[model samples]
Target: METLLSIIFIYIFVENFVLHRFFGICPFLGVSRKMETAIGMSMAVIFVMTMATLVTWLLYTFVLIPFNLGYLQIVTFILVIASLVQLVETVLRKISPTLYQGLGIFLPLITTNCAVLAVTLLAVRLEFAFIESIVFALAASVGFSLALIIMAGIRERLEMANMPDVLQGSAVTLITAGILSIAFLGFQGMLSL
Candidate 1:
């Protein structure tokens, strides 16, 4: 339970997908302009990240380890993540047309999101147990959602602010991300595990 809590806190604040680890910056910057779209993208990301972690963990433990083919972790994990995203896209479109429409282009773009891949790799690197990996993955996705939501809120406000031309768009977003990263760095000493 303590480890699970630690994973939750770590992923949400300490090792945030965008601020600290710098994963999925493309969508983090591009898709975060509107709160609605941001929420949709975040949801898709959370689903894909969690599923990718489970499938990748299973492949690592059952397939890769058994075959002594750990070297194929990256390739196998990427393939699994890509396929999982596609499957999720199809399922969501079939079951939830509203959500499918809301997510729009971001759903397909998740295939290349580094955060999805990073969580899988980090789970293996940490050698988390099967349950622990799932917990970690879910926690990580929650963290990503938290960050995206917060960023979208900020950007929504920023859109109304009259900023200089040089500090517009990606420039301002990057600066905000940098500040958020610095804030997240404060959590580094919070947990030993």
Candidate 2:
């Protein structure tokens, strides 16, 4: 139980996929201009990442290892992740057209989101149990959502702020992301326990 809690804490505050590990920056920047879109993308990511972890773990354990197919992990993981992303895209388009449109290209780009792939691959490489893999994926996705939402909120505010041309747009966004990454570094000590 304590180990699980530690995993949760470390993933969320210390080794966040977006803010710390630096995965999934494409959607992190693209869909974060609005809180609504950011939240939507985050939800999709959480669902996809969790589902991908479940499927990939099962496949690796039950099929790949048994068949000496460990060499196919990357290709297998990509197929699983891509399939999950398609499911998310279809569902989101049906239930929330506005958000579907708001997400734009970034929605499809989730198929290539390194964070999702990283979670699945990491779970196998770390030799996590089924439950542990699920927990880790959930924690990582939640951390990603937290980072995206925070960035959206800050960007929304910055839209109205007076700024020099040099610091506008992507420049400021990158700088803000750097600062956020630095702030996340403060959580490093908590992991020592």
> After superposition, which runs of candidate 1 have C-alpha atoms over 4 Å from their true positions?
none
lDDT of 2 by residue, 56-165 (tens): 99999999999999999999999988877777678878998876775544557788889999999999999989998999999999999999999999999999999999
**TM-score to true structure, per model:** 0.94, 0.90
lDDT of 1: 0.87
Q: How does model 1 score by TM-score?
A: 0.94
Clashing pairs in 1: none
Best of the candidates, lDDT: 2
Best by TM-score: 1
- Model 1: per-residue Cα lDDT over 1-193, one tens digit each: 9888888888788887788778888888888899988898888888888889989999899999999999999999999998887887788789988877877567789988888998999999999999989988898888888888999999999988898999999999989988877888888877757
